[model samples]
Target: MHRLVLLAVDVALIVMSTLLAIVLCGPQSPLPAIANIGLYPLITIGVAIPVLWIFGLNRTVWRFTSLNDCWLVLAAAVWIVVFSIAGNFAFDGVQGIPGSLPVMQGLLILCMLVGVRAAMRLRHSVRRRGRMARALFRDERENVLLVGLNPIADLFLRCAAENAREHIHIAGILSNAERHHGRSLRSCKILGPPEAAEEVLHELSVHGIRIDRIVLAMPHAHLSRSAQEALAEIERTGAIRVDQLSAQYGLSELMFDSAARVRVAGSEPSVIAASPLSSGELPASSYLRWKRLIDATTAGIGIVCLVPLMLIIGAIVLLDVGYPLIFWQQRPGALGRPIRVLKFRTMRRARDRSGRNLTDAERVSKVGKLLRRLRLDELPQVYNVLLGHMSLVGPRPLLPVDQPSFSAARLRLRPGLTGWAQINGGRHLSAEDKAALDLWYIRNASFALDMLILLNTAKTVLFGERIDHRAIEEAWRDLRS
Candidate 1:
């Protein structure tokens, strides 16, 4: 019902924008001649609705409309103008609609679409700020002192700020760099180096600043010796709680009781794996049921909606590369079980003189590259989701040969069409790096995290940004050490 209302509004906006453009662009009013061009206007509407739907304009949640959504609206409007112009030329030659009219119509449509969404975003922001201010005034918030001046730390700070309902006040940052001391990040000051952790806490307390939590934003693998000592000392003090932000697994508050015992030494702390999930360590049955339900519903709707596109791609692939369009490979599924995963054959079955297959770069066809770029090749994996062999969002299934490297923790979760690692670094990541990401996902799986991954995947697919694998590998190694 909500969708219907949005659709109606969209159509009305498109029509009104076109009419307004005609009036504004032409020397004389085109209202009387609108009767003559009624067929073209109807054609415009017919072309626009589907184009807008294809661009996901109707599906965009207005309250959460972002720059990406605005871009989609612009793209859809451009397509509408292009299609309308083509229709005008085809139906009534150059005498039909003015070329300038289409251009003006497209501009107006883009403005209206983006304007409405922008207004909603503005209103939401204003309300959120108001709520945050009120909550802060009421002292209904936890003052958090974040440690580290890294990207992960920045992300945490941003997330906390955006979530007004959470009422997490970031008091300041504590970094290892002496130069960064007294510096500010997003208005949160950097207190001091790791050695100053105790001093800073005491100072905040002395100033009547109640720090309810101290968040160590550095990844567990990268926790510095001084940071570790500071954490240990903080634990010993027992006045405030400490939280460790694992970039791989997500942020977790480590109470002294539950925190893994660590000795402060000159060396880096060893990366401790989470306990294996046994019969006694399973997730709640209700959560598992809900996850399965989400997977099934997403896959079912995806298959139904995308069948036509898939069929078209299949025909093209058959013509381009000859028979057998679907490529099947054995991959590690839930609990290390072998499952046959399906994808559109993106590479030609080409071999070298030595009877060995060529590299992926050599075997990949032009159409295959396009399919991969658009991520259209993975559409067949919906079948795997429906068959319970995979999930809509989880760790990407690994080849049987690659399975041995992954921890048992990763194997416990169903492999997905898209995952945290894929969105982060994709094919650029090393085996160990990917495994770490997978293990992290398994440990910190949640509905919100899954949705975030899906949203990021959509953005990645839409905008073909290559992941810097080398840089990611270096960062991962640094975090681990």
Candidate 2:
């Protein structure tokens, strides 16, 4: 009975939009000559209602229609128009129906179907409708402030609108650019810069909206000393919380637990034989100790001196693709723990709003190709070295799904920015081959081997990744032995 009623309501909507389309297409009212008007709409109605039934679209809760529902609505619209036109042609002609009427009516039906559902959602939660919504039913919604002027802020807004309306009411956005101040993103006001966050919080409180949380959307942001002092003052309030988007999403540093460290550090691998040395035992060794010191010194100096170059690359990425200057992913580190791997974004968005996947070649821009060729994309990884999630030289980290069974061999030590496998074969090597070459590096780990890998890395960048089958065969022999 409930399904029948919903179907009837949709039919009524279809009828109304069909009439509106006809009237707008013609000069006069479609009311009086309704009897004389063609059967285009009659066929449309006959085909559309069942299409709606088949799609199960009437079952969707309008107040929370999701993106999937929108796609279903789109598909139903296309099929309705195609079948309706076919039905008209089968009847010999659509008398009195203009050629363009069916197309216009189809579009109108789509808009009305999606719009009515969206309206219900807006009425259910937006902040501007807060007073009326409270009168209807009360729910605790956090007055949240978002910091960042990047694409991530926009992503968060869409997500919160679709999912967290009852629990989060975004107060406003804080941008890093002065030009964007007094502007709006997704209808939420861009209050000002992060430097003015304390001032904005005060202003918002004065206007009766108290922010309970602030989320940092950008990966990196710069602030003056006075601004940092101001933020410290806000932090002292003890009433608000600061959150990082990456931490909230559980993107990195999650693979490390006390137990995992104990297991990976002690386990003997079948592929790569290693001395029974843990992280502590290694630090006492002079060579191992110096490796960490060298990694730190090099990364600290490199980061400072490369700032201007990184900035130039950042601008190219922004103009070539869009927001999100940094791209990060979770990859395994030492002791089976994971680190948040960082790099500059090198491709366009993975998919469109409609959820259509794009090919890699299609998404790769000229700037991205150049960055990959010059190896500048790996520059951001120096920060990881500074943070000690990785070493200056070791086996490269691979995504968990892509790793082979012998991947534990690669994780025997901290992952590196460049390694034996990368310098010898890099992108040209298969996963199995990469595992073997990395095992060879593990067996022969030393200061001389590390220097050799670093020097070859320069050659690989100048030339290109070279595949050496002899190296792979030698590593495989050692593994079998």
Candidate 3:
């Protein structure tokens, strides 16, 4: 039900934004002959919405949406402008469309969409205020003990306080002694350390105060053995339900630009092993619905927009290299099954004297080389995603024969067009680095991480940034050494 409502909001924003863009671009409407331009608004919405998904905008709850999210929307808008201009220049074949129109359209569309979200935020703020005030006025406020104060939970509490809404009034902060006992953080006194959590809870309950949710807001570092043990003890009391703040808001220490240290006594730090075959892990099918929905939507749109370009490329490949313009090869699919992956043939059909195929770098033709460099070759795999054999973002699929130990470990899930490995090291990554990244992704795959990787992929491609091939290889070598 929550997802359905969110999806509805997403579709609404796309349509509203596109219509608003058209209106902001010029007169009440385009000239009758060019009134076909009105359809462009829908087209723009079609493009923008998927781009928003690619950027993982909807992953964020409205209350927690931040400036960084807005930047992503703005960047997606910019991409829409570029893709629109490029598509027009290459094909559209029509004249008299406003030169500045698309850019203006993108800006206005983004502003409107952002405005709608902002308006929701304002409403939320007012409602929270009303609730807080009501709680205070009715003397119905509970002595609320907030456990963690991470950014997201902080924002919610702040909203409540600012509005004076009738809700659980904050009594104090409950955290580890090292973090809050000796320090001043946002006016809330740290009443007791996590080690003293039970004593504190008992004291509150005995004093006729009721404890609600224990909002877990510690950084990833703070989620160490000591913290977990303390939290475990807290949980045993059956006095509070632990609402994990970091996981809910996607707020980790890495998300912050600043650095902070976590002190863990007598514990050795180790990297998460990179492998698809991790034990006791959930099946990738758990997210299959999300994967398929995104794939179908993205690929459907991509194929429509790229049909003309595909036609031209198809012609060039046919004339230059004869038959079989599309290349398909067997690669590992989800759970190590075999699937035929598709790409535009960038290599010739030449074989060795033994009748074996030549290596990729060797058989790769001039046009193919250009296509590979620009990533036009992989355009066809969008279909693979649509067909459910692949995903827009996950661990990049590897050839069955080249299967490294880690892929077998990681192939517990489906392969993706772009993933943690692709963004971090790409073609430059070593098996070990790829494994680590893939495993990390498997452990932490979410709507937002996928979006971040997709955005990063765009940045890498557009700027011609060298994939950190050296770093990847070195990481492998270091592991072996």
Candidate 4:
């Protein structure tokens, strides 16, 4: 019912904006003659409604509308303008409508759509601020001490800043970097290094500032030994409870919800799970069934829509790399099962004197580089997804040699074309970092998180920001300490 209302509103707004644009651009007052207008305004609205639908604007939550959402709206508006102009030229020609009408309609429609959504967001924000003020005055919010000042930590602080009704109030930050000692994040001062957590707690206590919880916001793989020790020490003290914010928590809190509910914690150091999954054990959840359904649907649609492109890419690969256009590798899939993953061959079949394969840089062809840059090489994996050996979103399957580095929990799920780790840092992350991300996904598998991963994956692929193996290895070595 609400969607129906929103759809109607969208259609009405598009039509009204088109009419207004026509009037504003007209030399004569009011609307132009019936002959002059012809189907111009009608055609403009017609193009706009479908374009907006394609962009899923009517279904977007206005209160949570973001820059990405606005971009989609802008894209839709541009499409509407281009299509309408072509439509006018084809149907009415220059004599039928003014040249500036379509341009004016596009700008007006874009402003109306984005402006309305922004207004909705502003209203929600104001209401949330009021609630937050009440909560702050009553001292009812949980005082949280954020540990780590990484991207995840920065995201958390951003959420707190944007939403006033958030249940967690960032009291201070504890970072491992010495340069961040006196810096502040979103008005919260960096208290000290993680090693000085206890001292900071005592000082805060002395100053009558009580911290209800200590949240470890860094990636598990990135947590240093000292930071882990600090978490253990803080947990043992029991003065303030400790919570390790996983990818699930961070994403949910930052993107979907203003307040993320705390997961149940066992009476142990929060750094390590009490009963980590071992080999042969899979975490059971209904969400996995939903995830599989999503994987199948998306992969099926993708294969159908991209068949022509796939054929073209296959031809290009064949010409560039010869014969076998598709390369197959035996990767460890769900539950340590061997699965043949398919991809467009991006490298030549070159070997060294010992018959071992040459380095990737030596064998990679120009066409392969372009295919990889656009991530078109992975299109063949749609078959793997359909065959049920993989998912659209999950941990990247590891080679047998790399399996030991990842936890059993990560291996329990089906491998993916793109995963949490891939979107977060992609090939740049270390084995441990990837393992940590995969473990987080395994524990918090949900339809929402899967969608978020897919969205981020699109952004990552579109921007061509994938890091090289040498850089990844260097980062791993540098951060391993």
Q: Which candidate achieves the best TM-score against the true structure?
A: 1
Off by over 4 Å in 2: 1-285, 352-355
Error of model 3, residue 322, in angstroms = 31
Give model 3's TM-score versus the native structure.
0.42
lDDT of each: 0.75, 0.77, 0.66, 0.76
lDDT (Cα, 0-100) at 123 in candidate 4: 97
Task: For each candidate, give its TM-score against the true structure.
Answer: 0.53, 0.43, 0.42, 0.51
Candidate 4: Cα lDDT at 392: 89
* lDDT sort, best first: 2, 4, 1, 3
What lDDT is reached at residue 434 by model 4?
69
lDDT of 2 at 347: 92
Among all windows of 10 consecutive residues in model 2, the one with the lowest summed lDDT is 275-284
Clash count list over all predictions: 2, 0, 17, 0
Query: What is the per-residue lDDT of model 2 for residues 1-481, given as tens digits with 9 covering 90 to 100?
Result: 8888878877788888778878877655667545456676788789878679757888988878889898888867876777777777778476676677778878988998899889987876564467536733764788889887665677789988766666788899987779999999988999988889888998998998989998877543344566566666777865887777856775333232224433333334554443222122232335765788888889867865776698799898899889888898998788678888888989999996788998999788888998989889888898788768888898888787776654555677788999988987888888767877877777667898899889999998999989878888987787666
Error of 2 at 259 (Å): 7.9
The RMSD of every model to the true structure, in order and in angstroms, is 18.0, 21.5, 15.0, 18.8
Model 3 stretches with alpha carbons more than 4 Å out: 1-72, 144-165, 174-182, 191-481
| Candidate with better lDDT, 2 vs 3 | 2
What are the per-residue Cα lDDT tens digits for candidate 1 across 194-264? 66778888898898998888887775445577767877878777778877767444554332123343222
